[model samples]
Each structure stands twice: as structure tokens, then as C-alpha cells.
Target: MSYTLGVDIGTFETKGVLVDASGAIIAQATRSHKMLVPQPGWAEHCAETDWWGDFVYVTKALLCDSQVNSEEIAAVACSAIGPCMLPVNAAGKPLMNGVLYGVDTRAAAQITELTERIGADLIMARCGNALTSQSVGPKILWLKQQRPEIYALTAKVLSATPYLTWKLTGDYVIDHYTAANFSPLYDVNKLAWTDDLAADILPLDRLPRLAWSTEIAGHVTAQAAQETGLAVGTPVTVGTIDAAAEAVSVGVKDPGEMMMMYGSTIFMIQLTALPVRDARMWYAPWLYPGQHASMAGLATSGTLTHWFRDQFARELGEGAFGVLAREAADSPKGAKGLLCLPYFSGERTPIHDPQAVGAFFGLNLTHSRGDLFRAVLEGIASGTAHVMEVCRALGTEPVRVLAVGGGTKNAVWMQATSDIGAVPQIVAENTIGASYGDAFLAAVAVGRVLPDEISVWNPVARVVQPVAEAVYARQYPLWKRLYSQSRDVAHELGGGA
Candidate 1:
């Protein structure tokens, strides 16, 4: 049987999957990587090692584990943590470590500078987004101004997926969904690149050509085939950001259906019938043409749990998150009245505050590690609910929320999100997320499958229903107040640092 290969580079891992024509996974493999924090507000990944290196390792592993012939693979696709900023040389080598997504807030100054120079209204009108940590335009400007040495040698700017596509197919292409994150550089109405907002960011020619997620960009080269164990000249599609692909994996294509990705950060994307033009949330064309998507996310989610485990549950050793989940589950609904702000990487969406600091309010000597951990989960849940509130205010409440990612395995976190957000979540039968979606997109690109067939490919496994709780009802408000009341102090501390 023919097969499609899919790979995705994540914040902390890379996963690859080989699937048959019927959407059954033949084999899957994964590789771990570290996210570099060179400074307090920056996040980076070495493109050669973490991005492309993990990809080659995962793809070869998938092929070897499945014992699948390279010629049997019909097509390949890739997705990754994006809307990132990576300047590359003429040969498509990364000039520096790849700047990560919204979690990295080093461009706060550039964001402010561009927002003021080019009026916020104009940017919102043309780009369909407000300048925030997620916007790649500011980061590009930061590179141009702060690292001119690298910028001068830069031949093109690319995100994670295109970087992979280039390495595989020698094509510089980006899907529009990923391109939209380059604010002031991408014009939403025209679905094309633009330097009208701020020409000084970089020349438009330095960007990758735009294509749809399901469009074939180019064929895999002989060199790439040798490294990846795929047949030479295999079709590769122009890929998208990890979250959008994850959304597609769970059949979240209809308007009002949302995908809440519980990954390193809790990212949410809601398909909308029309552009929900607001600066509080981001808007972008969907993977397909003429479609729209609205996005919101918290600055940190699973990463916070990682930090907590490293600091508080070191004794548990491996599977610390699982052990921490049990401890958190034992804590009361509101974590014994403790409230937390999951702004360790600064806040995003609804409240676009970069200086926002993480805090655990109502902490007392009586609190246990369980209470603190529970507070952390609840804080992330509260942040999620805040985003849902914004979507509702914009009259776009999701018909259903499809939950995906490794964090979904954390029962306490998933239940807390639904309970605090007062929203039911639908978990798909296959939780492989972006890589699975990439395979499906690859099949679609080659006309092997239709988009709507995703339902038949992977049906719903179970649903997480929101349980009403008086504790959450009372504590969520305080959670909001905890951030607002301490905003000044948080900024002061952030500044002093």
C-alpha cells in the first residue's frame, strides 16, 4: 500500500509518522531537543540540530521501525512550532539560532516602535493582527537592527516548516497561515507580502513565496532523499504552523470549531466564517484559501508544569509530570484558595503584556507542593478561560473545542481547563497531533484523500465535560484580579531585572 510521511518539530520534541493510504499509522518515532534561553526573555532552537537534525533522525527512525521501502512513500509534509524568525544565508543555512514563537518576547521594543511608527489601526487593517510577541515582523526588525552582521548576510527569512521544506526540496515557500504571523510583511486582504507598512523591516523579496498548506511546493532532492531515506523526487507540500495542522488533525475545519492545543504553551485556534478583526486576538487565512481563523494562547502551559516538576518534584525522577498530576488532583478545586498567573513567559492574547510576571497569590506556610502545583494548573485554566471570554465577546463562541497535544494526557490540567472555562472538550482517537495532520495534508495534496474524510480517518475517542464547581466560579475572578492588582509590581520587578 502507498504511504505518506509526516514530521513536525515542536518546542521540546520532534515527531514523525508514516501512515498508510487509509490513515492508519504504520510507524511513529520521536526525538527530544532543548529550547535555548540565551537571555531572560528569549527562546531559541538551533536550526541545524534541533530543527533539521531532529527531523532527519525522526524520519529515518520511522522508515526503519516500519521497514517501509523509500519508494512506497507517495508524498511528505512537515509542520513546526512557528511563526518563528530565522534568518538564513544564501545556501539556506540558519545564520543564528531560530527565534521561537510567542514565548520569546525579546522584540518588545521593536513591537512598540513599529506599532507607533505604523499606526496600530493600519497594521490591524492590513495585517489582521496587532504587534505582539507572536508577530514575526518585530523580530525581523530586531534582527536587522540588533544583528546587522547576520542580517546583512541574510538571503531570506523563514520559519520552522519552510526551513525543513527548503532542506528537503530546495524551495523557499511558506503557507499563508504561517505567513500571516509576519505582521506588516503580510497583507491579509491581498494574501501577499507587503512592505508598505514598514519597508525598513526587510525587502519583500527576502521572504519565502506564499502557498497553501495543501499545495505541493517542490520535489525532494537527491541529497535530501539520501539523508531522509525517502525516495528522490517525492512531492512535498508547503507546510504550516504546528497548531493549524493540529487543528486539522482533529477535524476542526468548520466555522466555530476550535482546537485548544495543550503543548509547551496553551494555543487556541477557532475557525470563523468571517474575519474576526480585533487586536486582542490574531486573524489569519486558514490552510485553505478564502477561509479564516482566529487565534489566542497563553504564554505558558505544559512548560510551567515542567518547571514545577524540576523545582518541586525532583524526587519523583522520570514521569514526574504524571506523579505531579496525581498530587495536583489530590488538591482541592481552587488549590486551597491559592491563585496563580501563568505568565512566566509573559502573557499573550486578551492581555498582551510582556512584562507580566508569574505569581502564586494567597500562598501560605500551610500550602503543600500539591497545592502549588494545583494552583499552577488552575492558573493556566483561568488564562484559557480569559481567551474564551474574548472570543465570546467577539460573538464567536466555539461550537466545540477539540483538545490535542501531550498536555492532554495530564488529566488534572484538561479537566481543570474545561471546568474553569466551562467548555466541553472533544478528544480525538489519535492524539499524534501535527504530524498526523501533516500526513493527512500530504494525502490531500496528492488527491489521495479529501479533507472531510478526517472524521472517518480518526473518530472521536471521548469527551471531557466541564463540571461546574463553586470553587472555580469564585477563584477565577480572583485569578483575574491577581494579575491586575499586581501588574505594577510585576512590571517594576521585570524592569529592575
Candidate 2:
């Protein structure tokens, strides 16, 4: 039987998945990789040293664990966070470290310049996206202006997915989804790089050709095969950003379905028959193509939980999130009138303020650390509600919400998210997320399943419905306005702290 492999290079880890022709994942592996913080706001990954290198490590490890021969693999696909600025030389090597996504906001000057050049309303109206920490356009301009020396040698600027695609196939090409993130550079309406903008925006003269995420980007080369332990000449599908791939893995293709990922950040993706554009949210092409994805992402969700556990929960010892969650689960709804904004390191969507910091409002002496901890979970759950309500307001019907990510492991947190969203949350059988979705996409590309038959491989683990309606209805509106009142103070405290 033939198998397919999908690899994902995420912010802090690289993951790989192996799926047989029938669409079931046979094996999965992951490798932790460090994110380089060169400056306070700068985040980078070494393409060869960490990104592509760990991808190869996980790929081989997955195949080996699955007991699958290299020759039996039919196709491969990869996913990575992007709309990044990775300038590679003629030989396809990164000129320097690969700057990460919106999490890195070192390009403030570039963003300011681009914002002035193209009026905010014009950019928002034309591109269907605004320049936030998310867009790659400003980052490219930043490099050209700040590091002219490296920019001069750049043969091509590639997003993370193409960087690995080039590593696998010896060709440089960007997928449509990845290209869309290059706002101000790409024209969404025309589905091509904009001549009007590209005329002045750095040299797109050497930009890579664009393709659909499922297309066969190129064949695996001997060098890639040796490094990843896959067979030479293995066909690899042009992959997409991690969020899209994960949505596909969770069977979020049908128009009304929503895929909620509870990983380092909480991201929601709902498939749509037509474009659903809102400056507050995101819009992208789906992994299967031909349809748009309405996306909502919270800048800090699980990340805040991690920070809390590391700093304060250590006194409680290991598995702090688990123990703290159990205690918080018993706390009264609304955490006994306590609320958290959860913008520890800025925020995205609904309120797109980067300077916004997290805070606990309505806190009283009666509140314990456990009550505060549970309040953080509730804060994140309310954050999901913020995104979900936006999708509803934007005209996308999010019928069945599926939860996939590290956040699902906490039963209390999952239930809390479902409660706030007012939608039942189902967990996927294998929640390794985007990498698994990439594998499933590869399996389909290789004839493992008919395009429509992809759902057979994905099954629900459990469906958690929203709790008592009265509780959610009362708390929901109050949760929304806390951000409005606290955001300014959040900014003030954030600057000083």
C-alpha cells in the first residue's frame, strides 16, 4: 500500500505525519526547535539550521516509526507559518535567519512607510487585508531598507513553505494561500501579484511562480531524499500555511464547518463558498482550492497559559496546567466575577492592537491563584467567542466546530471554549494538527482517496456541547466590552512595563 507524508514547521516545533492510501495516519513524529529572539520584538528561524533541517529529521522519524519503506511513499506535502520574509540566494540558501510571522514586529518603520504610501482604506478595500504584524509586504521593504547588503544578494524572496519546497524539489514556487498573505504585494481580486504595487515595491522581478497548495510542486531530489530518508523522485505537493493545513486535517472543508485550533495561539478557520473579508479577521484560500477561508486568530491563548505555569505554577510542580485546570474547573462560572483580557504580548483580530497587554479585571481579595488561573482559561474561551461572533456577523455559517490543538487536552478548557462559542466542539481522532492535514492532502494528491472521500480518514473523538445557555448568554456581552474599557490601559501599562 502506498503512503503519503506531510511535514509542518511551526513556531516552536516541527511535526511530521504518515498516512496510508486509505487516508488514515499510520505514524507521526515531532521535533522541538528553538526560536531565536535576536531582539525584543524580533523572532527568526534558521532555514537550514532549524526550519528545513528539523523538517527532514521529523520526516525520516515518522516513516521509520510507521515501518513504511521510502519507496512506498507516493507524495509529500509541507506547511509552515508564513507571509514571512525569507530572502534566499541563487543557490536557494537563506541570506540570513528567516524572520517569523506577525509575532515579530521589528518592521514598525516599514509598516508606517507602506501605510502612508497606500492609504489605509484603499489598502483595506483593495487587498481585503490591512498591514498588521501579519502581512509579509512590510517585512520585505524592511529588509531592503535596513539590510541593503543582504537584500542586494537576494535572488528570490520566499515564504517558509516554498523554502522547504525548494529544499525538496530544487525549485522555488509559492502556493496561492501563502501568496495571499503577501498583502499589498498580491492583488486578491486579480489572483496575481499586483503590477500597480509591485512596480514600486522592491524587486518581484525574481518572485517564484505561484501554484495551488495541492499541485505537484516538484519531485524530491537526491539530496532531500538522503536528508529526509524519503525516496528520491518522490512527488511533493505545494503546501500551504499551517492553519489551512490543520483545517483540512480536521475535515473543515464544508462551508458551514469551523476548525478551532487551540495551540500556542487560538485560531479559528471557517470554510466559505465566497470570500468573507473583514479587516478584523483574515481571509485565505483553502488547502483544496477554489474556496476562501474565513480565519480568526488570538495572538495569545495557550502561550499565556504556558507563561503562567512556568512562572507561578512551578511551585505546584510539573503538569501545572493540568492541576491548575482541575482546580479552575471547579471555580464558579465567570471565575467568580473575575475576567482576564489575555493580551499578554499584544493581540490580533476584533481588537488588532499590538500594544495591548493582559490584565485581570474585577479581581478581589477572595480570589485565589486557582480562581485567577481558571479566569485565564475563561478569558481565552471568551476570546474564541470574540472570533466566532465575528464570523457570524461576517455571514459565514459555522455549524459544527471541531477543536484541534494542545488546548484540547484540558477537558475544562475545551468545555469552556464550547460554552463561550455557543457551539459544540468535537475533537479529531488524531490532533497532531496541520502536519497531519498536510499528510492527508498529500494522500489525496496521490490517489489515496477521492477529493470528496477525504473525510473517511478523519473521525471525531468526542463532541462537547456548550453548557447551560443562561450562563453563557449572561456572561457573553460583558466579556466583549472588557477589552474596550481595558485596552487603552493595557497599552499604557504595556509601554511602561
Looking at model 2, residue 373 earns an lDDT score of: 86
Off by over 4 Å in 2: 315-318, 469-475, 493-497
Clashes of 2: 0
Top-scoring candidate (lDDT): 1
lDDT of 1: 0.93
lDDT per model vs. reference: 0.93, 0.81
Which pairs clash in model 1? none
Q: Candidate 1 residues 265-361, lDDT tens each? A: 9999999999989999999999998899999988888888889998988888997878788888999889999998999999889899999999888
**How close is each model in CA RMSD to the real structure?**
0.8, 2.1
Residue 224 error for model 1, in Å?
A: 0.4
lDDT of 2: 0.81
